[model samples]
Target: MQKPLLVTDFLDRARRYYGDHEAVVATTGERFTYDEFGERADGFAAALAERGIEKGDRVGVLDPNTHYHLEAAYGAMQLGAVHTPLNYRLTPDDFEYILSDAGVDAVFADYEYAEKIEAVRDDVPTEVFVTNDADAVEGDWESFDEAIETDAGFERPEMAEDDVITINYTSGTTGDPKGVCRTHRTETLHAYLVALHLDISDDDVYLWTLPMFHVNGWGHIYAVTGMGAKHVCTRGIDAGGIFEAVAAEDVSYLCGAPTVLNLLVDYYGDHGDVPTTGDNDVRVATAGSAPPEAVIRAVEDDFGWYLSHVYGATETGPLITTSDARRFFDDGSSARFGVKKRQGIGFLGTEVRVVDEDGNDVPQDDATLGEIVVRGNQVMDRYWNKPEETEIAFSDRIEGYYHTGDLATVDSDGMIAIRDRKKDIIISGGENISTIELEDTLYEHDAVADAAVIPAPSDEWGETPKAFIVPASGDPEAPGTTEEEIVDFTREHLASYKVVRRVEFVESLPTTATGKVQKYELRQEEWDDEDRMVGEG
Candidate 1:
């Protein structure tokens, strides 16, 4: 009676067990059942087969978080074709690089992002183009909806657990972005790990706060669907819209980055009387940035939502570690709540260790600094079409482990605390300034909505810390928020070298597709004239 472990098998099971259960709710007030979802996925699979899509073909999807995206992703998996979700916000050149890099054979895009594909369609080798909107269709493009109107369902391809299912492109902080190919085996296991950590169940109504393009939407698309849980899709991250959806859709669980959590807390503070449909509390799982202790405490105390923190990168299936305070904080003390802000221990299926330069494990005393390395089934299969880079990534400077390029320390209690990115640490005036540390302190300020700390060149010091801020609600154009105020805030909490030397107010911090603040981009402008790419770590 054991069922197959493939993603398609999960979809079919959901259809049978929860056939009449609602699956996806769109912002436009449209809803689909598990049965309807399976039918649409099957229809799309047949449509792709009709268009000559076969096993191993690379199909790129460029769309926002929509019901169609889920259908297309599962459909491609059914055909054994690799589903590559492109970030719709990428520039034209970035899109061109990825399309050509992956050698995508077909592209399924939303009408809003069709123009980006059209601009580089000739440069890339994509042959077939499918768009969601008929009115925006251009030359040689087919209607995505019309193509799937046929009643016949395509036969599921014979797929092994190890077959590659998705290719996720890295954010490319240093140079060109690398395509990280993930196998079905890894994806399936990662989903289980996430679901187990978050305690997902059939009654949980999950929301799509994270983009589907980012690590398979933190793998909830499979984990939630595998449990036959309902998915509430949000078109975008608007404060009012998310609140309304959470209450109206009866959302019980959601995953987001620290930025998303910050926005939610800000929204709830400004607009009181937000209502929830059910008695069960909403649980939020956040990552991407190490959330400030203040934000974590606020989400738990003010909003009355249970909060969990996790840490991982794109190459690690993005769920290698989680911080579950409940297991350790049974005493329910405020100090235990503060400990929840740490990245915590590795997930069940992963092995994490802090190693020195010689690849030796660091002491568990919590003071010894070392690189956080990981090995797991969730690790990416390889960098697509780049064997040399793949080898470098897997077996480069560190030997067997996949170098996370992040610095951390493990406490005696086995909790892992992230210090900073290997490249984000600044050495100025013979002292080290962790940009992450400085930024975390700055975020505790009441007026700061978001903060990014980068290294700026200085005449006296090799490099100094510079803070870029997004004001919480104050007017940037009018007279508000002096640099001295922020400097004073940082000084009260940090050492002299760690204090921000320069401050620039901006509307928003530049973020990667996965919601990580792209600190390298900010450092680029400062280090443009410098000879070296970066100072010694």
Candidate 2:
């Protein structure tokens, strides 16, 4: 007899086999066992059903990484309701667009984000509003605690593997966000892949640094939970908070974007104790922007943490490629690890290819750049409520494969190096500017903390490169670098055309909830009121 592979299977397994295991350690210092976690999830499922939520209905959750958020997510899935994790950091307008686009039925918001939800609640036809903290609630929202206090469990809905389980909206830097619908099959496969890549075990103590709303917290919720690993939840991102959690919880694994890693590296270098707890190395998996080679080295060599790089999008379940260079490079030299930092190759169930404009596979020569395309179990079902957009997203330029809109090159060793986004590539006076290449070089500088390059409007060259920088060790009141100094730094490393012509010093770059620098927003500000740079034919 073939057992059905569903997310509920994981929940049931954990409850039955690992019932006594610690499932969640809340930010409030409360703990729950696997049995208690499963019961709470089931109780929430019943509660959701009482509010008229049924199979295939879209339920949105807007909260940080918390125990309630995890329970709400699993509960919605169990009841066959599509879990749409709202980016809590998004503006009200962004929320309006997403809620209207997804046709969300009910929203489970944290007390902190109740205001944002209330602001956009009128625009959305959402029936039920559930908030985590009762005292912090607004706009007639029900308490999440009260809802889940009932011990009754709802009957698990009959769901096929291909049924839509989640609708993750892309961070709308370019335009109105598109909801990427992922099925149970894709989610299950993604969890398995992540578990395999991270080498998760029952003994592993996984901490939640990445927000659960972001690609199901990089799919760790399922991966770690399935392995019956201890989950340590963080309320927010603070250097002291992370340090305290790591030491107190004895965290074995955590995932973050490059921005998170940079913050940790900086924090640990300044204040953290060295030689992490007797061979129990804290392993960090980061994606989004690739970490600079220096950051990677500092994390592993200086901090004694094993850092792995992964590359994927929200639509692809966000676990496509993992850099497992330790297997290929036994020497563990800085150079060998540096090679692994360039995105690397696809995961077990994924196949990646670099294709030219005509969709022909590009050669494995390091210099030949092409568009990155991927196909795998984790590929999203479609963009919800946007068929034309979904069609364009899947086969817009690549014919059959889902076009990543990312430019990359394959090395002789079959490793893939992400060059830049196709839209983010800067062309000035017929010279192409690789923003990623430029950003990588700029990040290597001691003064620069983070950098993003975008094409600025130019009267002479048609378009010029503009660099937005966040300094490493500078007073916010005094950045200490002129435009000429930054331009000179770029000139020393890159060619004249690729050098940053405009420089903007800011405390921080605009980022997505997942910590990706929103370069599209920067481009929009630079090209606003000009129709010439819209990439029209």
Candidate 3:
């Protein structure tokens, strides 16, 4: 009765009960049922073992959102190996750093990205190189197609629930990306939490719009698979492709960041309209940032999809809180958008709180700012190979809680809304101006879209809010709204003290692959010449 929880059990459950169920709709036009997918994973594991890859070996997977990446994850973890997924957005140098840092014993890369891996193969001590396209592969690499056909004769290795199973790298905002080590227990609990909150079921047809490399697609790969839902993979995010997949596959649920949703909204508005006749009852789970209330409204009224806003980071096992106020919103209240905008209280098996510097709970008035702290089974235990950071990440003003490094406030209803990242909070003169607040206001303007705010070096005010906006048209050639017009629009909504002083109408904001705008990059450029970068609070 006391079986150790392992991620491979998700596939095992599917294979045993739902073997005939269609599991993966690969981008390469390949379809596999649960039985077939499991065989492929077994073969992949067998091939790795054949190459002398043992349990506890770190297997790196460098590819986009595809069935290959998914299969590679299960294959590595099936043999009790740690699967390290590399971000494709990062350069070859980043790859070199991550592959070397994770001590990757084997790597399975996509055909298109084989060169990036080949460039860093010499630097990294990886023994096995497996690629989808064997023609492009150099350095005695194994072909993925040929390897999966070989029946792996090895039995499933023993695994503990607390065993480190996956090593996910952080966004690397300040310096090198740190690996967040997640255990089998943490990942299993996270999958269950996500599935429970999202109400993911066997009937749902999940779309792979989000990158598979990012926190294992925010743990959907496990949750969806365990539920026996169909996975329709899209190699890249394009509005047309998304609609086509939804129509063709009858997609029921998908997840993405606010940026991805914004792109879909703009694409629909500019190019054509979303397919109205299709069976498109879409439910999108958005994180990465607090999306504007207007964006939430557009998703529901304009795009005809239900949107749920969740919040967490790589350290917190990713799904900490959610705003699943469906029953409350169903009454046709005007405040639904406002309610949907807030990142609601802790998910099941998680505890979240907004606390001040002394770790005491902040007043529930919703204006008082503090760090969002969490304690849950979903939170990761340590950062891989970084004991100091591991100690610091769990250094709670409150004992036994993990400090989220995100500035937030708790409303009267216990909804936890994120105001800004700790480093991203702009201190103008002596006032704390949340960049998120300004950006949310910018989203209210019909013409302005995909906005980010940062602190600018101000001669008198120490620092002031500046805006980088992407037009709603999503066309670089089209001229965006004027700075004065934007400033005037903000003055109507926000107080003068919190109002943005300058506006830079850029074609797009620099964003992480996960759809989070890299505000630090813009902030550094803005304060490059200034003696002091951040303002004194």
Candidate 4:
């Protein structure tokens, strides 16, 4: 007999087999077993049902990497409601847009970030508001602790594998943020691939350094939980806290972006004698952007932990390719860093290809630049409420495959390495920042006449936004705006990560004969000292 692949089965299996095992190590030092976690999720589901949240309702979870996020996500999923997670780093305006766009019925916010949601409560369509601490918030919010203490009950809704259960919002590249709808089968199969590729097991102690809001923690929320692994929760990213957690909890596995690895490397450089691992063998997976080979070398040799580099976007599973191919390099050899530096091979059952504009495969000569496209079971079904955008995303330059908008090259071994970005998106500190948005924001300032934003090489962030501006006065020397002022203006309007860190005053922006701004020239000028415009590797 065949079985339907549902995301709820992950938690159910853990509760059935590992009920007595410790499942969560909360940031406050509290521990909860699988049985206790399941009960809390059930209680949350019951409360949602009481609040008129039906099977197709959208539930928003705004929290960090705390146990509350896991509880809220699973709780909504159990009731067949869409699990929508919001980035805690976003501003109140962004929150308003996402909440209104997704039509979120109810929201469960962490005490620290509930105020942001409360600021936009009157603007959104959400009816029920809940937070971990009702007293800390100055709104009509329900306390999560009290809500789960009731005798109310909820029933599981019969769901098909193709029913959309989650909606992850993209970081508004060209316009308003688009919700990427994912179904139960896509999530479940992605978890299985993650488990198989990352070598996750029940005995492994997984650390929560990556934010659970990022592609559902890049699907680790299901992969690790389904494996019955121990989750070591964290409030935020701290180098000292990370090392301490590894030592204290005996963490065996974790995942992060290249920014996290840079932090660890810099921290180790300052404190050379810090502990890097615990009793179990440590395996770290990195995505978002490729890490420099030097960083990868230091991680493997100095930190004594294995690093696997993966790649994908939010539209895909956020992990369609990995660099963990052990056959390419011998164990403990220096050549492995070069192999791992590439995005490497596609995951099993995932078809990743470097294609030209004509929808034909590029040669595997490792020098031909082509756009990376992918087709997999883990890819999203469609964009929420945007059929035109969905059609363009899947049909642009190819048919039935998600266009990553990332340029890469394939070696003779079919391993792909990213070279440049096709989209006007700057990936600073592993967060996507749309250059068009920054340019638009700059145009709002009275001192700026013309502006173009590009990715500049950042040693710490891997990539930082650099803006070239033409003064309204038509004189570059006496521009009305200061570099610091432009940066401050962006911080006030946009998210912190999307702020432009570097600014250059110019008399005229490089433009084509047709009067269009030539951003490629600006990028080349900004990244002249770097190996590639994309990232270090």
- What tens-digit string does per-residue lDDT give for candidate 1 at 1-537? 844456666687789899999988865688999999888888888899888899899999987898889999988889999999989889889989999999898889988888888888889989989888858766668887788898766877788877888999988887798999898888988888988998999999998888998888888889989899998887768877777777777788988788888778788878887663345579888887678877877777777788888888889988888778566775346875656777898999699888888888889988777888889988888888889987877765477678888888888888888888888888888887788788888877867888898888887887888898888765555325789998988898987768898998888778876678888788887789988756543
* Whole-model alpha-carbon lDDT for candidate 3: 0.86
Model 3, which residues run further than 4 Å from truth? Answer: 137-139, 473-478
Between candidates 1 and 2, the one scoring higher on TM-score is 2
lDDT value, candidate 4, whole model = 0.88
Worst 10 residues of 3 by lDDT: 325-334
lDDT tens readout by residue for model 2, 190-307: 9999889879998898888898998888888888888888889887687667766777778888888888878878887787574343335688888887888877887778766788
Cα deviation at 187, candidate 1, in Å, is 0.7
Model 2: colliding residue pairs: none
Please give the TM-score that candidate 3 achieves against the real structure: 0.96
lDDT of 4 at 387: 99
Greater-TM-score candidate between 1 and 4? 1
What lDDT is reached at residue 332 by model 1? 47
RMSD of each: 2.0, 1.9, 1.8, 10.7
Off by over 4 Å in 2: 151-153, 272-279, 473-477, 534-537
TM-score of each: 0.95, 0.96, 0.96, 0.82
Work out how many backbone clashes candidate 2 has.
0
